[model samples]
Target: MASSGQFAIVTGASTGIGLELARCCADEGFDLLIAADEPEIERAAASLRADGAKVEAVQADLSTSEGVEKLYAAAKGRPVDALLANAGRGLGHAFLDQDLADIRRLINTNVMGTVELIHKVGNQMRSRNAGRILITGSIAGFTPGSFQAVYNASKSFLNSFSFALREELKDTKITVTCLMPGATETDFFRRADMMDTKVGTEKKDDAGDVARQGFQAMMDGESDVVTGMKNKLQTTIANVMPAETLAKQHRKMAEPGTAKD
Candidate 1:
């Protein structure tokens, strides 16, 4: 049973910032439909339900159009109040050394599938002229990630796309807010095989705090947010720094075997 007719959808909600984002929605008394590629999504649903929110979990791979459709179908045409497109994968290595298949999947999951789902749900929101969208971009988008080339490129696409979409929909009640976070305490570094890199091993922001800030920004209809002072500074500098300089700076942080003791 839903505590409220209002509902929110969060992708990649099995863990990390995604799960925390779902929690934020639930805390706001919204029903939730959360998805992830892993079976752990069920556990995430259970946890939310324990807190009194009506929650549904769909274990769908969000890297393909078919998977995106599966999630969309689960909504059963309900007017979603909010859509948090947070599913994405990261890769860390020299661009040439990365496997082609991994690169393709990253692009598909981060870029293609996200836009596909947004297109479907966004049209629904536009029809009603009421809704919100929170895209999980990253500070990584602002920099040229040398060892993490493809992943950063994907974030960059999202950052640009979100702003453009927000401008296009400015006349509507629907709001599109991009959540650009810095590195956080998530499994992202481990999954990206970046444990040996300096950036991977460095201290990171808390996932819960990041998600809370993002959710609030979405509710407030803010155009975008960069979570921390350090990251804010990074973005400001990135705007002025030369591309080659940014790339080299990224290399120092992301290059393998660079982790400090």
Candidate 2:
């Protein structure tokens, strides 16, 4: 368990994996500053408070620089001991079918906002020579996403960036951990408009289970962890499979109207 005074920040804490991650932190005795774009963040914070940790919830759209700054300001200058950059957006459809605004929002939230926050918090952690960072990447990054093109690409960027950052910080007390989960049981599918796809309909790991794996890996200072054994195998195969084959496989699962009976 962390010391009671330890401070942690978790983004996307309104629901799903992010909320679960925040719960894990609170259970481990860390004061929390959790943020999301929705009002539900307040309710999530209330639930976390039951864990006997101080909790602050900020409702801010993390897709914009202003929103990211608002969340940082809400931290009240506390030196964050643990940072979970879990906020993200997903889109599902053929590239050409996606609205320009939606595409930009997805990229801004999943890539730009995530990187900016990491840069801000990471610099502080580096200067202090102490801190832990967990980035929520995804196994989808390992393969081509035929329907969910932009979302997967953003996750790929995160996957690569997390590794590079971890290596750069190897000599310091600051640890950068990436948590790659696959098809977790969350609102993600519905929000991404993927509920009609085979992958969306398939069984998924529980959000709590995925969060537990990620949280434990972060606490142990691991560089990366892919949650679930099935996902582990998928990632391994994705690495060896030809790009064209991988893309085709992704199409079968993510192509529109492939929902199972």
User: Which residue ranges in model 1 land beyond 4 Å of their true spot?
Assistant: none
C-alpha lDDT values of all predictions: 0.95, 0.94
lDDT of 1: 0.95
lDDT by residue (tens digit), candidate 2, 1-261: 344889999999999999999989988999999999999999999988765668999999999999999999998888999999999999999999999999999999999999999999989898899999999999999988999999999999999999999999899999999999999999999999999999999998999999999999999999999998999999999999999999999999999899999
List runs of model 2 lying over 4 Å from the truth.
1-3
Distance from true location, Cα of 155 in model 1, Å: 0.4
lDDT tens digits by residue: candidate 1, 1-261: 336678899998999999999999998989999999999999999998998889989999889988999999999989999999999999998999999999999999999999999999999999999999999999999989999999999999999999999999999999999999999999999999999999999999999999999999999999999999999999999999999999999999999999999
